[model samples]
Target chain A: MSELLHRRTVVKELLKKRGDMVVIGGLGAPAWDITAAGDHDNNFPLWGAMGAAAMIGLGLALAQPKRRVLVVTGDGEMLMALGALATIAVQKPKNLSIVVLDNEHYGETGMQRTHTGYGVDMAGMAKAAGFARTMNITAQKDVLRLRPLIDGMRGPLFAQVKIDAEKLPLVLPPREASYIKNRMRISILGPEAALHQ
Target chain B: MTTVSKAAKPAARAAARRPRVAAPRPAPAAPKPVMPAGTSHWAEQVHPMLVEAGIRQVGLVPDAGHSRLIQLCEADKSMRIVRLTTEEEGVALLAGAWLGGEKGVLLMQSSGVGNCINMLSLPVACSMPLLILVTMRGDHGEFNAAQVPMGDSTQAVLEAVGVLVKRADIAADVPEMVSSGLRLAFNTFRPVAILIGQRVSGAKDFRKLTQPAGDINE
Candidate 1:
């Protein structure tokens, strides 16, 4: 398996163990691949939807303290709403987990260079902003190493996964966008039974 | 004769002593007007308005015009007032608040309205509820030239974004407008703008109130 798919597979397996409110961002085909495998419910677009998912997750976690909120984000999109991390840190929702897919490019935006290309430490930033737990995984083996850490985390957590940009799969054009948007709305608002239909 | 003179002198002295003055009568005590203590304070008037509207989260952009309202929100524990670096940041913050299940309001000035035009697209596209409290800046004899362009177009821009805009030019209109805007925001699950005219916000002097320095920070 390619490095991108392998890392996604490991992350997906880890996420399946935890039952939480998960919001997936439009990173690349990996996010779509994971969602296709029925790993998460809500899949939000990341154009203007970047910083909002985490904030919404923070709110949901605060309102429903018994449940956890996990956000699957991309490096480019995360930078757009970086200040929100500081706000989240101050709020310190223990049930929040932010997983950043750092391929070092805006793969959705035609593979443009993002701040991550300038050697920005996305996980370190989250940690400095006050996330109690943080990790950076560069290999599929290290991705597997996160199972224990993800299981043991009690508060806000951040994880950055570095994968080969060229290895990440490209989703088929316009159809994928519509499918993700429709599926996300269904995930957020519709019954789980209706999702399969 | 000497005995008779002593009795007469004593009685005369008692009679001439200015009728025993009665402690000068305390100058009629100025009839201290029956003004209710704490009623004149703005916090008393504004805090209840926020509570009654159920406004728990407020995203603020600093403005001299909104100083009083901001102060009121800051003093209130029930209301979480977040000060943003820019007006658009405040709009984005409110959008997050809406998605998170908390109702939010943006507090800014007319000039800041210009800064928020681009960011308004997020709410419009997402179909989220936003309640914005705007202090009017440019029109109605504004002294500042910088505020003119945005102040003139505030209503038009808001209307273009599908936001229902209400103007409170008079003091009597403020409370009802705020309450109505809050209701509409929650009911419609879309943003609403309440514009407080310059005369209303500018007429009041907040500095004279002797507010505690650490009230807002806390």
Candidate 2:
């Protein structure tokens, strides 16, 4: 393995100035990574449904065209629904960014090697799919450079952040999908959210 | 339990006037303007309802039963259609759409409904407004035995997973059936399934199908 980067540090840095952004975390490790970064009311962390993180982000970006949307998923999770990259690129929502925390394994299912480890270039695939910005970052400085593009640039951005393939402490978000969803909804829409339509 | 949309009530939309989704596909070999005779009008009637309700996102796992509806969505610029490789993605996609202040519908067939079973937990648990339109196969003179099992069990399976099921066996009943399903989904913030009977789609001609009997044997 060529000098693996740390997943937590990558996620934490991406979400550093995450003001009013709606973040969707893919099922397993990425969900844990977001919780580790510190759960917020705007975070919709998936406890199940393996390959939906990116498409969900696309829908949210389309619905709230002004609000920035970010999806954080793992390589295994990203690989499961790579077709979504094309779909997101087709819709081309400028406020959306999809980041794959590539540890090169399915951390939740057992540390089995994923396609990325075998040299499946996800950033290249995103670029081919027509994302405005695509990057495969291995170093912290590159991630630092990427932070501004994710935060400030007008984009349908896709980034694959390569991280160390190692086990980390589980920081599970609230498993109740309803509570998490409603909390996020209430945060974005206010207390009168449910009462309205 | 409810999320009112911030969507502007754009002037009374005509079936002819397209609003958004700049035609993505290159017009495929001069399109036919007419609907085929004997084709189910289920999609014709329901497509407008979705538009009226401001459901602009349409997701599907293509099925012969929903061919016309899919075509209608593609033609109707008001809807942004996402053709999914699998049916489960629709559930997550629609949930995300609703949370972001828009409405969506998922169109699939009975066999594809089975693929969505586990993912149903997302809408049920989150109380997301999920509108599912499933065209029924394997019921009433099913030519293929493979479709029979899931077709018969679809309603029960959907119900067991907490989705309220509605059936529209006749073309005339399709509008009311779909409208009720929409009301149940958005007003009450529940997931509702509307099953379109094969009687409305008519049975496919196995003899005309080019696929030989040996091609799909397990």
- TM, every model: 0.70, 0.83
Chain A TM per candidate, in order of listing: 0.73, 0.96
TM-score (0 to 1) of chain B, per candidate? 0.70, 0.76
- The model with the greatest DockQ is 2
Give candidate 2 misplaced runs (Cα > 4 Å): B1-40, B75-77, B209-218
- Model 2 lDDT tens row, B159-213: 9999999998766777889999999999988999999888777767676566777
* Residue lDDT tens for model 2, A75-98: 998898888887778778899999
- lDDT for each of the candidates? 0.65, 0.85
DockQ of each: 0.09, 0.37
Off by over 4 Å in 1: A1-7, A24-34, A37-47, A145-154, A167-197, B1-46, B87-96, B139-144, B203-218
Candidate 1 lDDT tens digits, A129-172: 89988888776776776655655547788888876565555432
Interface RMSD of 1: 4.9
| CA shift of B202, model 1, Å | 2.1
